[model samples]
Target: MRTREFLLQELHDLSQGIQGPFPYDDLRKMRETKRLTSHFKMLGDDDQLSADLNTYFMAIHGLASRLLTGNAEDAPTTAIHWLARGDFFAIFPMYCFLEDEWEQFPQFAHMYGSTKKMQEIVLSLLLTEDEL
Candidate 1:
């Protein structure tokens, strides 16, 4: 099993993309994301959300495997492949806040200077169908 350090490094790589900046030491985010991995693992793969989560987890796991085995291969997945899947990095603030226990997403614009698309994504995740 991959350790917490490996998981955190994956998240850091995802958020930073092309190695923009070394992520700050955020142990809380690491723990929360680990918990999320466990929770998402229980869901059926048929669900879209479940599938996306599985894809993401698998992508990171693959990257971790490559790193641990001294096989530093650069395949397309997550923020490392920023040119191909750049949106993942663009919307990374959501994960930052999710790690912070879900802040008022409406202020994502003010806080992170996020755009309409990002706001809608956050709203869709946070609000119910009736609210939308």
Candidate 2:
């Protein structure tokens, strides 16, 4: 498994190019998001940090994938709908970590490592604009 700091670095690198909403609609079609949510559900209590990292990566990877779209009607907006379910509550994992008093994300500490950062690195897939 990658270290926590490595995942943080990945997220920091990811947030650099995002200017608006995350592309989670594309993520709804990605294998990675499915894997992320599945792994999230299977986590044990001791793996809260792992869960946090997974959520961050899920969102960031999605955003990075959409950076080149060059069009809006192509992907007008984004949402967290894929992770929300009637069967469960879907808190962004970093906020949940903070509520548990877990340390804030080192790379995102300026926002106390929450909220705005969540908006920064939201989810989509690797598909190019032409593919979408």
Candidate 3:
């Protein structure tokens, strides 16, 4: 799928009690930020950074795919733990993802200013929903 489609599906899948065909507006809101695009660009252009990040993203996506395809146990927790313990430069996108949603999500504000905690919370929250 296209990146935008993936993100929109991810948001819908991860949110609890959100009834809908899908919230295109919210997806647009999240995607409109230049900050997110910048990180994606960086991930694409920097070889070393891109290699590491690709691995991380693949791991995360594997968990997500498993969750969506009937492997619920492989949730975001493992990926989150991996991120918290790995190279700090590798997790910049996740940090930006949490920062993007934190202001609008007060409960997630607890994760603010701490990258490790934020990464954990982001994974936990994403994996908390009943539906994948």
Top candidate when judged by TM-score against the true structure: 3
**Tens digit per residue, CA lDDT, model 3, 17-97:** 222332334334434566555654454544343345346545544554554555646466656567555434445544444
Instruction: Report each candidate's C-alpha RMSD, comma-separated, in the order given.
Output: 15.6, 14.7, 12.1
| Candidate 1 lDDT over residue span 3-97, tens digit each | 54554454344434322221222323433465555543453353243233334434544554454454534534343343223332333423432
Give the local distance difference test score of model 2: 0.38
Q: Which residue ranges in model 1 land beyond 4 Å of their true spot?
A: 1-47, 74-79, 82-132
- The parts of candidate 2 lying over 4 Å away from their true place are 1-14, 17-48, 71-79, 83-97, 100-132
lDDT of 2 by residue, 12-130 (tens): 55455343443333323321444345543555454454345456445434543444343223442443444221111235442242343222223323332443443433322323335
The best-first sequence of candidates by lDDT reads 3, 2, 1
Looking at model 3, which ten-residue stretch has the lowest summed lDDT? 107-116
After superposing candidate 3 on the true structure, give the runs of residues whose Cα lies further than 4 Å from its correct spot: 1-47, 74-78, 84-122, 125-132
Work out how many backbone clashes candidate 3 has.
Answer: 0
* Candidate 3 residue 18 C-alpha distance from true site, Å: 21
User: What is the TM-score ranking, best to worst?
Assistant: 3, 2, 1
The true-versus-predicted C-alpha distance at residue 100 of model 3, in Å, is 14
lDDT of 3: 0.44
RMSD of 1: 15.6
TM-score of 2: 0.31
lDDT of 2 at 19: 39
